[model samples]
Target: PWSSRYGRRNRYGPSPTVKVATPRDIRAFFMESESMPRSDYLSFPNRDTIDDTIADMQALAEQVLLKVDKTIEDQIPPPTAVLEDELPLHYDGLELTNGVTTVFMFSFPDMDIILPQVDIYGWTPDVMSSGVFDISSGNAVAWEDENLRVGLWLHSGWNQTAKMLQQYLELNDARYRREVWTMDEFLETNVIGSKVFIQQYDSFRNAKIVAAVRVPPEGVYAVASHVMDLATYLEETYPGHGFEKIIDRSDVLMIYFCGRQLTGEKAHPDLPTAQQSRFIIALVPEGS
Candidate 1:
């Protein structure tokens, strides 16, 4: 407001004089502001300081996004990690754990029923083919020392039976005893029952381990099942088979030895298979 004066003021104590704006200056400024260079009147903070602050903020945002992406990436395991645990399950040195209930060893045979004691439900007599054991169902299990290519299921959610087999193969005994029925006994026994499950796999050298397991006709497990025409279902879903009849005379269920599920979904049929997903299912029936 003092700049309104026309005359200037002197510095105090007569230290060399200094001029200060008065009322006249303020009036002159308002009167000529429109014609004056506007930027001269409008001052902003230094440009370098503002630019540095904006750059700092952008860098901080980028760092935050990078950290978030890294954390999410670490949370999931790529499907390939299962390779070691899936094939040629060597139960002799297998570690023990109690969190899972059943275990299934595919790609090998345990006909003698040794090591934790499993009844043979399915066998591949072709020596070159993979064998399947109905290791456990609701807690039944078995173990053996045969040198075979085996995969063990170590956990239980839908496939509790598979976990039971894993426990035994690890040399840890399973106590629950469910009979390992031949297709004849199993079909005859459970045919009238309400719950039925079919597990499909991408069986191979480095087996996919578990392809899928669920109650059929209602869940995604429905991918490959038909009450009578199993061959077509297997071909469409798993895409390959080497079937053999197990129980030749079953009034209720016709059991067969289904061949291997190959390594990859799109892999060639002969590309080193793992589990016998069962085409029509060639079977070495129980007690044979």
Candidate 2:
């Protein structure tokens, strides 16, 4: 042995303290080897080599989040369907004809026509003079709440008539009410955007015809006057047929009288029995 004392111990406790590597330092040293090829870097072969790998991953996640937020903000969900399997169709436009205006028509192909159920009548002094029963103002005098009964009447008969006509056309049966003249429900439902006419039979006579036509966006005039003209035409053309009273008959004659001023017009020399007529007729034949 050379000098064992010199090699083993010196003046201090030991020659010098040899530094032992810490776990953190060893891990760091191994992590640096990730960039090399798999064969060259055995310690951390699959690990990322970047110093701030965690920060970079967080930044990329934030970018993805921003893109998702933008997509959600820009897009709107589509509206849900209300009437499933129903196709949108526009109704036919009606034309003013024969002095009478057609207001609406409700019919289906190979099916019976749906008659109107409502009508509205307007009241004025001129109409009162026309000898038509003025149901305008009633005696609400006792109940002092400014009781006003405007010239309005509910015609159930008219509604019944429409229903009866519909039934007749659909069932091919004539067993229906013959006295159904007016319909109040139909008047209330269909009387939209209508005009009130205070028609005078004669200026001096003070007689008036208070009526209104239910002017809908579609169809024929729902007025007694127009109905009467149609009925007359049907009776003339079809002759001795009860079809002149139904509302569903196509090819039924329709007469429209327009621009006939209500003042001082010689009592329509042609309509001699106008006074006796209580109801206007709208005729509909069985097969037509």
Backbone clash total for model 1 is 36
Lowest-lDDT window of 10 residues in candidate 1? 122-131
TM-score top scorer: 1
The CA-based lDDT of model 1 is what?
Answer: 0.24
lDDT of 2: 0.23
TM-score of structure candidate 2: 0.15
Candidate 2 stretches with Cα past 4 Å from truth are: 1-100, 108-110, 114-121, 131-288
**Which candidate leads the pack in lDDT?**
1
Q: Tell me the TM-score of each prediction against the true structure.
A: 0.19, 0.15
Stretches > 4 Å off in candidate 1: 1-159, 164-220, 224-228, 235-240, 244-282, 286-288
Task: Give the CA lDDT, 0 to 100, for residue 159 in model 1.
Answer: 26
